[model samples]
Target: MDLPRSFTIRESSHRILNPFTDEKLATLGRALHLAPGTRMLDLACGKGEMLCTWAAAHRVTGTGVDISSDFIGAASARAAALGVADQVTFLHDDAASHAATDPVDVASCIGATWIGGGVAGTVELLRRSLRPGGTMLVGEPYWRREPPDQAAVEGSMATSKDEFRSLPALIEQFGELGVDVVEMVLADQDSWDRYVAAQWLNIRRWLDRNPDDELAEQMRAELTTAPVRYARYQRDYLGWGVFVLMDR
Candidate 1:
């Protein structure tokens, strides 16, 4: 019925949640040749920025689905603010089971692949929403280098170290899913820093506003320690990218 608080808070602040700067986002749109009338289904569409921005850019219509109600509300407001409410819709639902009412030109599962278990399963789930020959956009992390220990991997995820794959293996995993990596945009260390560090600021702000709230204590603990863990483990050992996949 709910997603983690971190996701909801991140949704309310679009600028911080988006690790990719404008230039990078624009590059992704261009890489996909996003033009007017192109349809996209943004799975795990946090705050709906990717969907809303693409809708505005392409004059297209689409739906965004996420389990987080707070995220869905924020995303809906964003679409309205962009004057594209009619063109896009946001729903509070599980991304894995969100079947489209109509087939789309593209389907995307960015950053949140747990809905499908992993990249391969996620790709298969998204493929159900695409028209024949349509594209799927997947944003995922890959290991830049191996982590030094189990603790390093745990810091990168709330889950265990078994949750991820190395970069080359991830590419091959996509191939195993019957997807060709048509295009991709990489995130540099600066982008990673922006994404991970911004969460600390959000947590700090939350603590300031709600000092007595039980959740604030958890937030404070996370704020105090997350950055060090990220910088020490995840940041140096991992890289992320948005890959454009086409059914082959």
Candidate 2:
């Protein structure tokens, strides 16, 4: 199984596939104080950046699973490129039913919580793969401020205000799930710009090369409106972060 060609085309150049910069990702790794040989299981692990980098920096070993065969291939190459091929592995498979063959020191589902339906279900799913005292990392978006109306929500790319909770409420959500919020690294507007604006350029470059591709028109339409929509709604109203949690 694989992701839609359009999805890969839009993010072909993205290494992290999220709003997070490499520096931010490194900071999170350091903050975790990852011990050598720590084992991690990452679900929906786009491009395997997190696993590969951590394998290098922390000498951790991990397995990453994603639905995108293209990403999995890239992730495998990345592992070899980083000289950590032996430490990490990437699988092209659905993450929704993925459970670690052995309990791991850390389990994560970053950005793609929909693999487990939603935050609560995702947390539950990750817990199945985590050791008793191991950490769980969840990356998600929250509302920076309450949207004034449905239009505002739609502008932020959310179908409803309930799609994301406020920052405090998100923390409370982890608590309700019987997990302690231990640490977090958040994304700023600049990070959002880096993530969203980069897509326009990728789409433009692709269109220049493959103007007659089946998805070119759709990409062109998105490029036309994405910038304004992002700056006006997403950059201000939405905030994203990777949170570290432990069973309470």
User: How accurate locally is residue 244 in candidate 2, as Cα lDDT from 0 to 100?
Assistant: 99
- Candidate 2: where are CA atoms >4 Å away? none
For model 1, the run of ten residues with the poorest summed lDDT: 9-18
Most TM-score-accurate candidate? 2
Candidate 1 has a TM-score of: 0.93
For residues 92-206, write the lDDT of model 1, one tens digit per residue: 9988888787899989888888799888788888988999989999988877877668887777663554566787888888888888998989899898887777777777777
RMSD of each: 1.7, 0.7
lDDT of 1 at 33: 78
Q: Which candidate has the highest lDDT of all?
A: 2
Q: For each candidate, give its TM-score against the true structure.
A: 0.93, 0.99
Please, what is the whole-model Cα lDDT of each candidate in the order they appear? Answer: 0.81, 0.94
Residue pairs in steric clash, candidate 2?
A: none
Residue 244's lDDT within candidate 1 is 90
